[model samples]
Target: MPPDALALYATVILLLPMACFFLSSPTFLLVGLEIPEVTQLLRGLFNGYFIVMCVAGVASAVAYVISGRPVFAVGALAVAAVAVMARRWFLQHMDVELQARAAGEAAAVPRLRALHLKGMLLNGILLATVIANVPLVV
Candidate 1:
């Protein structure tokens, strides 16, 4: 397969989950996080997102390298690195916040909501970046 095609497919893999979450996340807002299931579901969704992004990013990096686009390869690697760090940070903080909410702290729900919003915002930025740079790569 052509390197450009490889990159395109790899990016599509990355974008698929991102677009899912981007659309689904706001729907989560339609419901409240006060429900235990909703919080856990959101948490699980984000965990999955991070994992998928790591795989997709590496795939994209390999594609970029094969295409002789080393700089884009580096960007892809950075995306993977960011996902790795963000995963750890998110899981840790999520656990603490979950515990706090479990313990009846008033602020925990809002914090979770903030995390949700931040994730959405970050995902949007990444999606925009990928599309924005497609002209250069393809």
Candidate 2:
């Protein structure tokens, strides 16, 4: 396979989370004044998280099938599971944030930072796993 194909695949997988993140924001989702259910409230959180996971899963599956690397599949599955768990944790923390806000407290920045950090971590893990599976083309 050509190097360009592999690079494009990797780029697609890496950009998926960012796409989801952008969609999750109200400012990013406004086509009109009214916001749809998918981009509103808790549903946005769930949708964004799950869609990102699904994108990553499908992307990694394609890469694994193309590259003939089962390790990529395993890494993708790990990433999906971690994403789900992290989503749950995010909801819990978001609840805390809401409570704090209701009590006249400011929102914490670490929560947002952690979300981006998690995405980076997943990307790093997937990249390393895929690179490790590169076969010699003798």
Which candidate ranks first by TM-score, i.e. highest? Answer: 1
lDDT of 1 by residue, 1-138 (tens): 887887777667667777887888788788888788999999998898889889888988887788778998898888888888988888888888899999999999999999888888888998898878877777
Task: Name model 2 segments beyond 4 Å from true.
Answer: 1-11, 18-50, 62-67, 106-138
Give each model a TM-score.
Answer: 0.93, 0.49
Which consecutive 10 residues in model 2 have the weakest lDDT in total? 30-39
Tens digits of per-residue lDDT for model 2 on 1-138?
Answer: 664466446545744664545444434333321223322354355547555875686676667556665555565666667667766776666556445544555434344334445544554564454445443211
**Clash-forming residue pairs, model 1:** none
How does model 2 fare in lDDT? 0.52
Top model by lDDT, which number?
Answer: 1
Let me know the TM-score candidate 2 reaches against the reference structure. Answer: 0.49
**What number of clashing residue pairs does each candidate have, in the order they appear?**
0, 0
Cα lDDT listed for each candidate: 0.84, 0.52
